[model samples]
Target: MDKLEAKNRIAELVQLLNKYGHEYYVLDQPSVPDAEYDQKMQELQRLEAKFPALVSTASPTQRVGGEPLDKFQKVEHHVPMLSLGNAFNEADLRAFDRRVTQLAAEPVVYICELKIDGLAIALTYENGTFVRGSTRGDGRVGEDITSNLRTIRSIPLTIQEKRSIEVRGEAFMPHHSFLALNKGREEKGEMVFANPRNAAAGSLRQLDPKVAASRNLDIFLFGYGKWEADSLPSHSERLKYLAALGFKINPEWKRCTTIDEVIEYVSYWSTERPNLSYEIDGIVIKVDDLQQQEKLGFTAKNPRWAIAYKFPATEAVTKLRTIELSVGRTGVVTPTAILDPVQIAGSTVQRASLHNEDLIKEMDIRIGDTVVLKKAGDIIPKVVRVIEEKRTGDEVEFSMPKQCPSCNSELAHLEDEVALRCLNPNCPAQLKEGLIHFVSRDAMNIDGLGEKVIEQLFQAKLIKTIADLYRLKKEELLKLDRMGEKSVQNILNAIEASKSNSLEKLLFGLGIRHIGAKAAQTLAAHFHTMDELCEATYEDFIAIDEIGEKMADSIVQFFSEEKVIELLQHLSTMDVNMTYLGPTQSQMTAIFSNQTIVLTGKMESFTRSEAKKLVEANGGSVTSSVSKNTDIVIAGEAAGSKYKKAQELNIPIWDEQKFKEAIES
Candidate 1:
């Protein structure tokens, strides 16, 4: 074939291969045989090799994987990926429904979806082409894992529409994939992962994308983060739109008009969760109408419009071998139950959290006694209760230590908290834990500075304070065991890169008591500079929304410390960035300012999200429902109940063309 013909054939093969792969992986229906798919893929690869410049990023051959990354870069989310509050039982779900009704002041419609037991990820598309994919780290910032995400055949490399958008989803491993992976690991005599969720997370985090590709991973797009198009007011409509755009959305989502239907959905899913090919820890219930979600807003950590109804945890019996104590960064002494290895759920259970001494006494959990263990949220393992009937008289009672295990400092029990705390600020254990937090992904984001590396540096006395990290030399890092020249350089480079991070990162890394990541972002944005933040009083902090009295006091108290002041000075000398660089909220002033508009039916000229954006750009808000307060309702072809309601309320209505002209004019 000629060069041009080869290019054309490559394109055809790429499309065919992608279609066949998607059909098999996502639709679970293969129209073409595997041999035909393989033949096309092989042809595409050969053509791409002959004409390297013609190879596209979206080509099916590219999914084989690329060179390993030294580290994943941090990506800032345009829209915060908020977590959901939990509902343990029927009462909790009912309470959630009541709260939604009271807030919305209308009968609520809900969309119930299986809360996939997997890693939460955000995929960004620019002009229909996948640009980036990231882990949902602390909501605001995430680790860029685009290479790994590309390997998932179900995830489209390009969409049907050419638009900029961000979609959120759960990337998971199927039960079969998990079993096969673990069986392979067992045969290879390697450590097996605990569950499908863990296996998926671990696979996605691989430095090499080829490793991730080998592990069969799939994704179910749940919602959009940002859709730069016309708006769809209902959540269900959005799902349909995403599917139309060539995204794989979970088909199990159901729209329920009332709380009773939601409850029924939840109850049915609770029993059916295990029967599915993939794991589902809970059912997510969300208000179907986008307007209700907007009106409900969000709490500090979660959305008020949605709640997750968690299934009861899977349980297993095991013998408690011993009790171990560990100190946290806050100096809280926590008890951990060391158990005789037993398989529970999908993984082996060797240890479970005891929570505190009070819990130990309440449960009468003695060492050498048989105990029932369960995973809380299918992630954290905890002792449910002691299997008293199975226990013998030889069981030994456990006790909480009076002193800190690591620092030998006297432990103090606070009146308000259950866990005993080590009040010594100079404790080595606290410093180590603080260092670990400082270099964490959401904090300083210093890649290659994991817990093991941090522990090694601390033990070697190469690093004493957070500021000491900036003073480390390449030679010093080389002294550590297993530290290669390349690894040391990477660590040094990460430390240097972290210096340019926004003030929020530094604030969170400081390990300030009562100040979480979100609060740090709020404070950073408000103050703009660390110097301004340091000078702010308790009143200044309290004035900010979401900054409570305790957090305010902690901020003021943290800044007041001489050591903290010294640390800040040293960091400033190192030329670390102290200002916020994220997008700031700007005031809107336009023709549609403060107007409540409702769009209904089909638009010939613009997509739903596009129309919504046009209205918002002109300073108007688009709502899902037609209410008495609605100022204008845009009716398109086959306008439905919203159109009739707007007419009854004597609200102004505009056709699709008229609406377009108004926005344009």
Candidate 2:
């Protein structure tokens, strides 16, 4: 076919496939058979190949084409995705209804939706085209998962409405998908996911979109976010509008005029949830009227107009086979229960947390005794209590090990602490755990060096410290299992790249006693050099915001250690960058210095990270949201919401050309 003919045919096929896909994946109704669908999809792919320019991201064949990302880029949400206060019992629901009545001041109408047990994701569409998708990381920021989300058939690539909108939803793995995935994993000798929620989350977080596509995940658009105009009076109507826009929303939602009706819906779902193909942990009750919801407003963490009525936690009685103790990075010895196989929350419960010696003693949990296990909201099951009535005389009492399990060093319990800790810094268990943390995403972000590889390297005695990772030779790596020449080279490159990372990453990766990622960032931003930070006294650390007396002491103690000082010297000698590379206002560039700038859309010359770094390196604060406070908005090709917001707010605007010129000047 000619280009024009191919274009028209492609459009027709897209419409047919979208319709068929919506029916099959969202509505659970199939109009076309698998063979027919496959034939049409093949035709579309061939046509697109012939007319390469016609290949759109929204095209059916383009759903899963992308390189496996080294890491996900963090995207800050203009609006925060907040959590909900949970109502466990009928009394909590009643109390929630009473609070809504008192606060809303208007007659309350409620919209109830099944709280799908899965990962919450936000999808952003610009002029009806799906542009971005992200996990609700800390609500303020999230990891970009657009490629993975595109593979989901239920999520439309484009809508009829030509408006920029942000949709929030729960991405879930259905029962059949979960079972099939686990079975496949078992056959491959890979550890199977404990629950459908975990499977869904794991799929979404996969670096490769093809892997996510194979998982067959689905989504239910629950609400809207960051939309400029939403004139629908009630949330129920908004849901209808979203459905009209070709977005998949849960069909089981109901509008309740009274709390009694809401309660009925919750009660109905509590028992009936088991019958559904997908998993749901609770019922979300929200005030139907948008205006009323606004009037009721939100608290610090959750909305006052909404509450989640959690189904009572699933519990099962199982025999406590034995308690297993594991050492952690911090040297804290944790106790886990190895239980007799019993089904709880639709998963086989073979392992549960015993939570240290105090908890075991407190519950009087003896081995071979019947124990009640509680699985709450798909979280790891915990040993709730021992069934004393069912206990036999032959049951064995468990005791905590007095010595470090790995090194045989004597374990010491610090005063005011319940759990025993292994103080040996050189303990193999501690080093392994610390190495894992050192290479984690939030830390040094060394790709290819994952937990399994770290364990292997540790066991091989090739790496005992974080610095040893930098010293990894390509030759030595080739000797390891599954380490091909290409993979080893990639790992070496990643290790090399991590050297230039901002000091905050190195600080967090160091596994200091009380220094977390945020605290590390604060410290790095303040001192700007590792040597300076090392010189910081307890008083100096205490003066910083968010650093408490305990953290300050910990920092001082950590830096004072001779081993830590030597480690720093070794890393520096290996050419690892120790100076903070992030922006400081005292730096040059009058245009960007101290300015809060927003960047939007695609840049031909620079990646988002490259642009962000340059802007930061020039002493500008690169913000995600555009508002009256924004000093400038750098509009790249096809700039979207932030550009429009900047225009609306009359903020100073810069095209990519102007931005480049300014930075160069």
Q: Rate the local accuracy (lDDT) of all candidates.
A: 0.86, 0.86
Among all windows of 10 consecutive residues in model 2, the one with the lowest summed lDDT is 636-645
Off by over 4 Å in 1: 179-195, 298-302, 312-314, 318-346, 351-370, 376-383, 386-665
| TM-score per candidate, chains pooled | 0.56, 0.68
Q: Clashes in model 2: which pairs?
A: none
Q: 459-533 in candidate 2: lDDT tens per residue?
A: 888999888998889899899877899999999999999999999899999999888776787788789999999
Q: Write the per-residue lDDT of candidate 1 for residues 461-565, one digit (tens) a residue.
A: 988899999999998888778889999999999999999998888999999998877677678878889889989998988998669998898889889999999
